[model samples]
Target chain A: MKLEDATPIIQLGEHLLVSMQGDLDDRAVLQLESDITRSVSETQATGVLLELSGLTIIDSFIARVIARLAGMIRLLGAEVVVVGIQPAVAITLLELGIGMQHLRTALNAADGMALLHEIRE
Target chain B: MVLAIESPESVCSIDSEASLVTVRARVRATAVDLGFGIVDQTKLVTAASELARNVLRYAQRGRMIIEELDNGDRRGVRVTFEDSGPGIADVELALRDGYTTGDSLGIGLPGAKRLVDELTIDSRPGQGTTVVITAWDS
Candidate 1:
């Protein structure tokens, strides 16, 4: 289907909190790529917090986009921290060859926000 | 010890996954089950997904065959996706990355070939297209 509605929420503080909502599939991934790239470029926050708690499935195309987004944020001199990755999403990411290495991942949004707070510290 | 399983039986025929956001997640399960390693899973899955999507979009309907070979310690998987639609008019341009017949980044065919061990494409202007992919563990 549409995979998921790509409404990237940006909460500006010392960092940016972007929560993704949708099924992370090939059909809707490219658009997310464009949106994330635009959001990061437009708002040069210290770090970007991506909350995937709303996601149900994490396809490979979406996985690649996640990897690329982390890399892109690094290129822009900002760090990317992921939060609320569902257990299913986590399993899929691992299976798809996505390493949690070099990327910061938290169990829930609260932890992610805390990590962001720590990073700002 | 080469085990040969004919077409249609070898491929993973899943539809909705093509459109799922976490499509890559299924790649490792499919690849490992097909006898590939965790390291090779991503490349194979991505490559296979590209070809599978092509079949769905271009051919409207088709079947994929994923043949895995495991003989005397050698392990690998071969994928053959066949479509009965109008075949490629220009295989050369189609193989070039970013050259898409549809709205993709056009990294489907060429990228798939590059990600694997062996690739053989058989297609004609009106007949159809057959993509044969083989990944070997060395």
Candidate 2:
């Protein structure tokens, strides 16, 4: 499936919300990193909500991509918040030693949006 | 070629990014069939993803084998990843978190180890690498 179809970027007010659903391969995740970065720059968004509740697994490679994507978004002057990480996925990530210490996360999309707005304000 | 298993419960070829997804799905399904809990299933699938990607990144191509194990009252799943790419020069260093020979976080091997109950790696420079991991249902 196409990257855009699997994970679409929606503009919400001054922010971009991407709900990543289904199975995303390595290439798709990499494509998403670039897509989100470019979208942030083009739209001049103030914040980004990356919803990952649809994803069942987040391995090391995907975790690295998320971290890098967050950093890139911040460089573009946009706040990014990851939302809806499944409990099992979170446990696996911690066990894998990927704490994602620098990235901001929320329990769900609504809370993530609030967190992003808080950061912007 | 790596040592061949007489019969693996399932086998998935690792040749591209798509194959990584396939391997994860296959492993997850096998885990479910073997009655692995949600947490255990997620851990096994994630580890399979990391290892499958490693095969593509380093070896260019490889294969994954899933086997169902029965030990008296216990049931488990075993996954083996084999690649004919340039083997790891320092297996010890490779297992260390944040030590990547490539442009990565360098936690695939070690992280995969932590997810499963047991993990072992065999590699020979200029030869190939084989990693085996097992998780038991408790």
Candidate 3:
């Protein structure tokens, strides 16, 4: 399925902002990874911000996919930041040890963008 | 509003990845209807997802039963995943974090335990494995 039909992944300027809402199964997560990686190279985006404010759950499967996607995007030369992780999700992830240490995180999308800028500068 | 007082909701014949996703959605919806907060619902659903995935990855077929748990004033959701796959040779090692038999990350069992109040695993090498997890309302 196309990324647009599944989730809102918008290309703004040189950055790709993805807003993940609702339930995301394994297929959706894989699709996001492929779509984001392609978008990074095609748009030459300097950064990608993933917003999870609306996502109620982030299991190990989803967490691993996010980590993988960040690494993939970085190889394509774009900084990736995840924002709006809920307190419950954070607590669960830490408890589960799916720390996702490789990816950058921020309190919100705007902060994530600012962090990307900071890294570029 | 709690209906499982009569009979627990059951999802049978989970033999593929797609079935695992269906189980997660079913568990999430039941948690919501039982008045579980979003955080608790996410925790239960996430735990269910992890266990369900284990059933698919290892056994290739399994069944799940979701029930409303009540102990006096306490209330919770209990999910039991049963599979006839080759049981773990070392349950302790399997329960340990960062231990995995397959290529995927070893976050299924331990991570699932942390997400719930009670987690129990019953398995034998030649028999099957049954994992039951319960998350109480705080």
On TM-score, the leading prediction is: 2
The A-chain TM-scores of all the candidates are: 0.81, 0.95, 0.92
Candidate 2 on A1-121: residue-level lDDT in tens? 6544468899999999999888888778888889999999999999999999999999988898899899999898899999999999999999999899898989999999999889977
Pick the DockQ winner: 2
* Candidates, ranked, DockQ: 2, 3, 1
User: Native-contact fraction for each model?
Assistant: 0.13, 0.96, 0.69
In candidate 3, what are the lDDT values of residues B1-138, reduced to their tens digit? Answer: 443453634555678767766787788887887788877877888888899889889998889987777776777777889999998889899999889998679989988998888999999887899999988887
- TM-score of each model, paired residue for residue: 0.58, 0.93, 0.91
Candidate 3 ranges beyond 4 A from true positions: A1-5, B1-8
Winner by lDDT: 2
DockQ of the candidate models in sequence:
0.17, 0.86, 0.66
Q: Tens digits of per-residue lDDT for model 1 on A67-95? A: 78889877887777898877654654554
How far does residue A111 in candidate 3 sit from its true spot (Å)?
1.5
Per-model RMSD to reference: 7.1, 3.1, 2.6
Looking at model 1, residue B98 earns an lDDT score of 68
